[model samples]
Target: MALPDLARRAASRPRLPSLASQRRVSLCETLDRVLNKGAVVAGDIVISVAGVDLLYVGLNLVVTSVETMRNWKPAGTPVRQPEPLSQEIRP
Candidate 1:
């Protein structure tokens, strides 16, 4: 079979934003977001020998700043909201 036209194929695809157009994120911002929202990593490891399972291990980890952890609340608990700057507004 004849080779497909490379230029024609590429032209059909949509163009992505150039580097200049994309927003740049700083390391501090990335860490702040991660700590603010927290991240959970969970996984399972299994070791087998000759089709027989020999060992199974599971791991779960949560990464966040101390302040973030302190603010965490269990399910069904009413969240406390900060008072609005304008006291005139009421629920």
Candidate 2:
């Protein structure tokens, strides 16, 4: 009884495209699409001591091609670069 139920569940699961049925994408094409559409890589890092988070670091990165940036803004909009995130610590 258990085995038959498990089989039925497996058969009902969604399946991905078969290898032959899917089109092959080159590295260049993949990179181009990602840059044009924009990709955000975000993560959080924690340095802890004895399960206590002593330091926490957040990271966010956006990677895009220069060509994509050229057309990123509206026709009448100005292009302004963002300020740097780092601050100089004067001791």
Candidate 3:
């Protein structure tokens, strides 16, 4: 009974596509849709008249990704540039 159940379980398990195939499918389905389309947001800015006065009463914050977070660095910090190779020297 145990052997038959094990074989049945192995046979019934769904076959998964390879990682490369999965990546291709994901790119085709979601990434392509987002890249090749524009998203338009239509909504009301003010829910109520009372909310206008409450807007500035709380903290105002901006969120960004790690790659873009460096742009917010304070002034005076030296940004390091990569050294050029010897072959790129000008005459």
Best by lDDT: 2
Off by over 4 Å in 2: 1-20, 39-91
- Per-residue lDDT tens digits for candidate 2, residues 1-91, read 5433432332232233453654433333433454444544344554323411111110011122322554587688775543222233579
**What is the C-alpha lDDT profile of model 3 across 1-91, one tens digit per residue?**
5433432332232233665543223222332354344654435863433542243222111111211334545588654322221124468
Looking at model 2, residue 65 earns an lDDT score of 36
* Model 1: per-residue Cα lDDT over 32-76, one tens digit each: 454444544434554323311111110011122322433675678
Report how far residue 6 has shifted in candidate 1, in Å: 42
- The candidate, 2 or 3, that scores higher on lDDT is 2
**True lDDT of residue 67, candidate 1:** 22
lDDT of 1 at 80: 48
- Better model by TM-score, 2 or 3? 2
Using lDDT, rank the candidates from best to worst. 2, 3, 1
Score every model by TM-score.
0.19, 0.19, 0.16
Question: Each model's C-alpha lDDT?
Answer: 0.32, 0.35, 0.33
